[model samples]
Target chain A: MNDTFKKLFSPIQAEEALKDRTKEFLAEKTQRYIGVRVGKRKHCLYAAVCACLLLMLLGGRWVYFTPITAISIDINPSIEMGINRFGQVVSVDGFNEEGRELSSTLNVKYKNYTYAIEQILNDNNIAALLSENEIMTITVIGPDGQQSAKILSGVEACMTERGNAYCYFATSEEVAAAHESGLSCGKYRAFLELRLLDPDITPEMVRDMTMREIRELIDSLSDGGQIDTSSFDNRGNGHHGHGGGHGNRRRNGRAEQ
Target chain B: MRSEQETIRAIEQYSDTVRRLCAVHLKNDADTEDIFQTVFLKYVLSSVSFESDEHEKAWLIRVTINACKDLLKNFSRSHTVSLDTIIEQPSRLPEDYRDVWEAVFSLPQKYRDVVYLHYFEDYTAPQISRIIGKNVNTVYTLLNRSKQMLREKLGGGYEYE
Candidate 1:
């Protein structure tokens, strides 16, 4: 039955009909006439301009600033972070902090510590901060209280400022260790790093705050949180608290911190 | 870079594929010709270059499908020829072939596009994915679902040769 159907519906060679039509079309397109060619030229010019304008509009230049922004973060020290115009982050690093790269293991910190980092992440309303390079800015705050942030350009270059403590978010080895060791959240330093980097966040406060408060903070941050420093043109320029000056800068920066 | 003559030759060679694709979609000779001309004109005017004949053919097929879709949209508004009317119109073929074509034409635009690209154009799911700008899994699922629908429409009795 299928064979019969195939034979009947298979493409037939209407070769002569196609060839004759092709010859006619080729002739028409190539034909030259001495009569007023200005109209043709004018039409061509108009089409070219329209095409150029359309290309310009669609050529990634006509930035439509969407209200919702997504940001990606790479937990890999070797990878860079990227922030799109819409504020979505895309990280492209191969490894996380525990020395494991792409392993599927989930690193276990203490329940409270894991809860703390998760709380900050949840409170900030981050879209998704996987160990990928989609994040706009990555703030690596050390266990010793020092902090630094870097914007990743590409997947290869680890572009960081000098003297900054670089820590990948979660390595496979760390994740495996966390899982096997059954370490409590307090044992994980990376989780602590995330807490310190978040200005409104503190470990002790997690015990005090309800889940709703934590969720609300995350929602607010996700919906254009006051903490987004990437939107400011002069981030970390030391321009304190006035409009176009240090005072306004300090106020805005402090608000996020 | 290919010369103008070479591009023209390529178009001439693949004109039949373009015509068949248009014919299958439009089901009207005049409309097919219009789409064919538009597709070729696009090829002539386009500054894009293809790495191989297969690439050029794929681009032409995609453009032809898009042109056919545009014509279908306009036809829906100004003309009253429904797809069912076209499918039911008398053909000289046997019932099974007629039934298959009818089912093909009756498919929704998305499903029909995948089926036509797969069966008529002989494109693999991955190739269809690239041509239609869809994920491989999506193309695979569309093909599987479309084929099942076609089988159901055929009363599930016919087996492929």
Candidate 2:
């Protein structure tokens, strides 16, 4: 029966086949060590390629992370940031003009998210662009979801410390879907109305257009017999009635990135 | 430490045993593959030399077991392979013995390792202890306990030492 057990439970893969895969795996790892996998006929080429890869890896380690984790902030102002293991901001992709300005303003290459956000918010140009009243949504994303949650909490605390009540936090994939559906920006009544008014309107445009400007456009469009205003009361009606009241974020398909 | 051809040769000779160890010990295929790849990678890069091929094989078994334990310790608990995976596998085992085979798998991890090395790999208790970094007496105790548990689950029809 022990013989039966030996015959029965020896692993299923044949000796030759598994060895072939392990050989392939080892060959691939050589590339990590020497920058190129050793080749039989092209030894010189392999050496050159390995040298180049080694240099590139050593050189770029300071500038980038090979396996990166990033955050996408979607609200009316859109910003995406990539962080390295040291918590330095390595890449920043911002969509709004203010966000773009923020991208340029926040040139600190090696600061944690909290410090980076604090610096960006304090920059004269970026500070001038921020309206404490406007809701801001931050989404943390990375290869590791648990670490992303920790980053999201740290970022939310940073924002809260700055006296921003309208700040919200979410995961990257969730915010990505929200941005795709136009719900993230639409959470803002004025921006949602603007989006309803023109789907192509930019976040900068959303920020520039006042509630009065949006209401006038809707009223004009209503009077012109192009749109209906009573139904415009759908979601944006509250902004006009209680502009000062702090409203809980409505989910009617709105997302802040 | 060996040339690429020599490394590949060694990998070809020992890969199956290393992989079997991983599949038996790890929770899922992906983690198993990770340890599998990592073990070979370590072999290719390591400077250590052996007196004979048998020593090389023993080193790999020791390393594979350590790598698996390290990964398990550093990470959260892993999701093990499902019953469906075991049932669907195209194994050499006779249909009647597959359930008993899986029952051995259901043993506590330490017991499973002891039973697998003792019964399938044909290692003596002292050999198993040396490979797995445990006392020889402890290996025999676990092997006995594992056999008792398997008997209860699989019934007395399956013979045991």
Candidate 3:
């Protein structure tokens, strides 16, 4: 039966005309087959390019929003700006009641830190405070790195254009301790000096005091009509440069030419 | 889609096997042509990668069988075609071979594929099950019943192996 069946189907070959006709049908159906592969390759290429662009967009967004250094400006309002590596202010945080009000009114987020500082100083309320000899301390808080030094130098240049303001650079650890005490870096530095003179002074007592009031309190509590210059200058890993402020220059008498 | 050269190579390689499977299930030249074009056109458009020549041949066989079944099941083609013209060019066959062919096609439509794949194509029962998407026991039963039917129709002298 197997041989008989083999012999039966062996003679029934597909005709040559049938093969020719099938080839023609396939060529017409597939557009000679070349068009389909090219179309598929183009589709794959487009999808890959779109995926790469999406990844780059997300990566760029992450890079732009990540802050590497912090600048704390304390003039009783006590607002801090978080600066990215690109020197843009990515965040503005208020550390006190008046600071929240000032932070809310400022449209300085995502601007360069210099422009943001200029906007703050140009505000009518801050300008009035500076003219009244209210001490405005601009503190740049980060590691003792080039970026921090650069931001501190830029801030000192801005201070030179005004009066009754100081520029300082502090380490991240000192700023973290300041945050734990619920004080910005500038007021926290004053509170540390005051705590050395009179150990009973608390951060809450200093949180509501103006920097001028804190400085006067430090001078009044000291032993010989002067606060400890060591506490004023060398607290943690930080350094200060006094600008042209008549009240501060005569009071502390620590100015760097 | 496959390249033109690949499609042509596949057509030249598998056309005869596809034609034989179409003959097992189909009744006319027009239906055979439709299955031919449908099967090879699917090959041209399909992205399936075959591991070996045997795998490619099995795929074409399965596709041709299914295409023939689809054409036969259509409402317009469901009417019975005459059994005398079942095998194309039946006049060219010898009387003994014609008797065997007639007996094989007479064993009901369900058994025709197993009979052809088993006796002619020399496929094992398990291979037929995988190709036809049926249980191995079902394929064994169909092959047994088809052999018995052929034995009865063709007489006891011939071995229905």
Supply DockQ values for each candidate: 0.11, 0.23, 0.51
DockQ of 1: 0.11
Model 1 TM-score (2 dp):
0.42
Could you tell me which 10 consecutive residues in candidate 3 chain A have the lowest summed lDDT? A236-245
Index of the highest-TM-score prediction? 3
Measured by lDDT, the strongest candidate is: 3
Q: Please estimate how well model 1 matches the true structure, expressed as its whole-model Cα lDDT.
A: 0.47
Candidates 2 and 3: which is better by lDDT?
A: 3
Give the best candidate by DockQ. Answer: 3
How would you order the candidates by DockQ, starting with the best? 3, 2, 1
For residues A87-136, write the lDDT of model 1, one tens digit per residue.
Answer: 23322222233213322132222222222223323322222422221222
Write the residue-wise lDDT of candidate 3 on A16-109 in tens digits. 9999999999988877877677788889999999999998999898888988899999988899999999999999999999899999999999
| Prediction 3 TM-score vs. true | 0.60
Give the alpha carbon lDDT tens digit for every residue of B87-145 in model 3. Answer: 65455556658787777666787899888888888999999999989999999999998
* Per-prediction CA RMSD (Å): 25.5, 26.0, 8.5
Give per-residue lDDT, candidate 2, residue A239.
Answer: 31
Among all windows of 10 consecutive residues in model 2 chain B, the one with the lowest summed lDDT is B74-83
Native A-B contacts reproduced, model 2 = 0.50
